[model samples]
Target: MNYLLRLLTILFLTNLSASANVITLQSTQDSLAKYSIPELIGKAEVTKDSVYLNYLEKKDLSTEELANVLYMHGNILINEGIMDRSRQYFERLDSVAKILKDPFYQFVSKLSIGEVYYRQKNYPASKESFESAHPFVAQFPEGIQRALAKAEYVYFYYLNGQFERYSKELEGIKKELIDLGEQGKVGDEDLDYLEMSKATVSVYLTKAYLMNEDFSKAEEELKYSDKILKERFHNKITTTAVQQKLTKGEFYFFKKDFKMAIPYFQEVNKLGDSENFGDFQYVARVMASIAYFQLADYKQSLSFSEAAMNHPIPIADYIDYEVEAMRYAYLASKELGLSDKAMQYSQKFLEQDEALKDTKRSNFINSILNNMEVSQLENDLIAKTKSNYVLRYSLIGLAILIVILVLFTVYQIRENKHNKEKIREFMHNLEESDKAEKAKQEERRISKANAEINSDTPAQPDDKTVKILDKLEEFESSDLYTDSKMSLSYLASYLGTNTITLSKIINTYKEMNFNDYINGLRIRFIIEKIKNEPKFEQYKISYLAEVSGFSSHSIFSKAFKKSTGVTPSQFLDFLKEDTR
Candidate 1:
């Protein structure tokens, strides 16, 4: 049995490596490319170098041919789970396409980049990239490329868990593809390609629909994929494996048949590691834990949860291992009457939870601003280099000016001209060195001040507000509220004072409610940043609000309007207009 298990692991690894070699360059002939998918699933050894050779020998290729080569390179890399590399190829292709002035390449490139980020599980980055590109799909004059880019975006958005955006794109892509085909603007090959791609996208849409709990739509979309697979493709080895696994998993998950879902999850896990991260394995583990817990199988639930925490794949902060696992560990231990183990687990969990709170972004920023201490001695080397640059430049300029003055005074004092010149040069050089040294010191002071002011660090009521604001003078800094979720109780606890005392302090000094006081601080900070720091002008108003402790964009906007009697954007425009 052990020997058989070893063999199974090897086979799984081999299967994944083979799957990673799947190629998808647009340069391949339509007929040949259509068969490649099936052949690849059959473990055919088709590689990217072979595709490159085929294209390289073609002497008289059009702009379309080059674009296709780049598309293929990007596709293979993406399939193989190398996102950063795939992004580079797609970005290059986009540039080429833009140079050719083809909207198809432009849209396709954007769609490809978004898909890469989606696979990498960077949903925010993926959403931003796709939304930026989606607007161009409608403006592209008339091209099959536009339809293809739209379809790609729709498919990947579904993967990114943006079901609403996915559905909207789906409706738009279907309509446009049909309209283009009916008008005879797109060729037959292009139409077939769209059909095949859309079917693939539908598979994901089915998954998304199921996830959204729209069972009827999920079933309908899966059926459509099934029909396309049966009618268009001759072989179904690998595609069948993926489709069956997905369908079974979703079906069981949606039905809440946790026990029934176990087998499918097991099958997916047994498939071995793919060239890509075994995300499905982790997913299965998480779901199995959930299922076991639901079925009252505490031991199995704890075991599965532990396995998930150990999985090599790293997800975002959506879940943390220590927190989730410790919860299960404590509960399971207590239920099993292991009192000693339960206490140990609970203690560990508390310590880790405290660490997380301290590391939260807002808290970190607050610490920085409150400290107001630069590691000057630690940055001595960097400061020395900067000072040297100023010293060197100033000395050179002073030497030149002194030389000019000496030459001008040469005719006036012929007897003592050389002596006077020496004295003048020495004095001039000394003056320049002193000036440069002072300038460098001033620069460091200004940088330290800016760092303090730029910080959205929370302030404690116990700290002298006068001293805090005094430090702002060097850089003309202003305070922005740094804590959005901060409450009076929390503040009072931190400051070693009651809410009433803090309220009185603010009322007497700042003359405003907590809300208005915070907003006023933010508005002042924003204005100072815009006027003094050029780069702050580029930051979105929404980001500024977050940095300033506004909980949401709407609240930030309302506060800005109330404080300045103008929106943030309007304020920015006014600043720009004044500068102009």
Candidate 2:
């Protein structure tokens, strides 16, 4: 549970660059872009403010320039932990974007606003802002910005604990970005940005994969992160250095390798920003405190916990808002025999534990209620402005379109029926031979069973595999395997075998890898239902795929075709024709 917060924040950083990378990178000179946000640290605040003021004072800036300034200023403020001021700039950007009909700025503005609300612990507003930005995803020209926009939403999905959406959105990001590159929509300079961004995405995906408990994927993402960073930045970039060390620490920390994680945490603490009052100083300290506490080094744990307490932890990272330092401090102090300090820490932890939790939830609820204020205004305006002629014409057009669709659908249905007749003719041609073959197979099976039943003794390592097969027979009688998340580990848990042994059994007996085996079962199950159930005959192809345990309709279609020599729709149509 303690690691959950750490896990989510780590997932957010590589994707949410506008919040400055989950929040902000500590001040640095290495520019990721013309207006790259460097996290404001100590004296760096003055320089950032001066830049913000300069942008404000300048009068001759063009629309793009002004939008860039506003976006940068908002990012700077958000990174500096200035939520109110950040929200103002983003709102201003949103207004300007709407006036200029610039969806890019509109998207950026909403995304930044979401980050601000997220950092402010206003989850509902954050979610709303992210959703608002979603429509603008396709509005950007195909390039890094568009990919990044989708990636930013991926961060939100991950942090909101929507792992399925997170994984899907993440795959979309990779595909879109890589596709853009392959299509030559990206130049060399753009390639550099893409590479770095991909590395960042890979880094965060480790946390996302870990959250879904896909340890193998997590490890793969982590290793890819290391490889990409070494090739691109070579640990020279300050943010890169910090993120790499921090992510490694988090990875090991989540693995419960407290001792293994310590060195990486130490490395992060050595980084320029995490040393002083950088954004991650509190994170490093709090996590280090927890790690040490886990190691039973109470004195060191208490020291780090108190150090964490001394800093203002931002809401950008997990557990930062509620401040886990006090919880560990209480335990560490007690372990160290410091009764007075332990009591004080315990009381503070208790106060924060529930109070912060409730405050976050209530803030989200309040935002939700407050959001209804003027939403109907636009609807009312649209309603008033619509003339009867316009409405009538629109309705007429819609009716025409519906008629066209119905005619086309009817034509398609006739064509399908024709195809079905041909298929039936082919089946009828083979029906006699198929019946003969089936009769022969049934005879052979019955003879084998009769011979086995007449045996005096039953078969006894045949023992465990046979036993497992029996349980599997029982299991296959139910719909449990229809769960979309019926992974190897999950099946192992149900079968009472370790994952290793289960894999062996599946490979030996099922004659396929785990994924293929599950998919095979799903296809067979759906085919059986389609054959026997009249209601299921009316089920949409995608819905059938889902009920049959596929996460994607495309995948289900492919698998079904491979297994049965026809698409699900084709097979279902065939079944309908056969029954008639």
lDDT of each: 0.55, 0.64
lDDT of 2 by residue, 69-136 (tens): 67657766655667898799989989889888887678778877887887777879988988998898
Best candidate, TM-score: 2
Q: After superposition, how far is residue 287 of candidate 2 from its true place, in Å?
A: 1.5
TM-score of 2: 0.54
Q: Give one digit per residue, the lDDT tens place, for model 1 in 282-361.
A: 55565566556556687887677667666534322123434545545555555566767656665565565565552222
Q: What does the lDDT read for residue 70 in candidate 1?
A: 66
Global CA lDDT of candidate 1, please? 0.55
lDDT of 2 at 90: 88
